[model samples]
Target: MHKLDTKLIQLCKKGNEVAQMQVYDKYAQAMFTIACRYLINEEDAKDAMQEGFLKAFVNMDSYKPDATFGAWLKRIIINQCLDVLKKRKIEFSNDEVENLKVVDDDNWDFDNSISKQNILNAIEQLNEKHKIVVQLYLVEGYDHEEISEILEIPIKTSRTHLRRGKLKLQELLKVKYNEARY
Candidate 1:
């Protein structure tokens, strides 16, 4: 945690509303973006972000200084988003999601050359299960074990979702890139 974050957290723990607002202002936009990745609706994302901030303030005692404030805030925001998704009946079937071992296409290579927008668009086009796993893995940098814990699935299911999601992404990007080349 930075000096500013430590100061803000200390003040927040002491029930300082201004300090809480300052912390919210500093992290809201980034946290909102994280929420938006999981929620298709802007309003839902905004609500989740708001809920996350409220939770953070309410649970100020749990804020350990070992991790960066942003990371801690992000986990809260992601959980809020996931909660919204769950309320919307986003189902994760163990039997259906298991063992989809799509062979990764090593020949299809994309680096910084591809536009971020293109990749994001492709990700948006993915199914909910695959998109969530992909975003959590590729964007949020969660491992299969952590993902399994978060999504409440077997570790193998998380791996299957990631593999299938990546393969689908590769297929989507291939078309877009090929179109650009020709």
Candidate 2:
């Protein structure tokens, strides 16, 4: 953390409203974008971001300097978005994956023709559980252990979802690739 950021966080911990606003201003837009990834509705995204900020403020004492402040806030925003999804009854499966043959393919190398936007759109087509796992792993750069902790699922379940989601995403992109070639 920068000296200035550390000072600002200390002020925030002391309940300084101006410092809090400054911190919120610095991170709100980026946090809102993060929330939007999990929430399709702009209103829901905004709500999640605001609620996340509130949670951070309430839990300001727990804000350690182990990670950058933005990363910490991002985690809070993601958790808030997931809480909203849980309220909507989105089931994150806790199924045992002992028998599932999960391929450990870290190869996300899509064809040259597949635009990043195209891949993102295909991710949206995934089932809720798989989509969340894929986004956390691929987009947010979380390892399966971190993902499992965040989603409260087993490490195997996270890998299984990522594998299944990756396969489905490839299948979707292949159709697009074929259409474009025709």
lDDT of 1: 0.86
Considering summed lDDT, which 10 consecutive residues are worst modelled in model 1? Answer: 99-108
- Report model 1's TM-score to 2 decimal places: 0.92
What would the per-residue lDDT of candidate 1 be over residues 1-182, giving only the tens digit for each residue? Answer: 67887898999999899999999999999998889999989999999999999999999899898888889889999988988888888887665654356455234356656888888889999999889988998889888889999988888888777777888998999888888888
Say which candidate scores most in lDDT.
Answer: 2
Q: What is the C-alpha RMSD of each candidate to the true structure, in Å?
A: 2.3, 1.6
Runs of candidate 2 with Cα error greater than 4 angstroms are 94-96
Best by TM-score: 2
Error of 2 at 156 (Å): 1.8
Alpha carbon lDDT of each predicted model:
0.86, 0.92
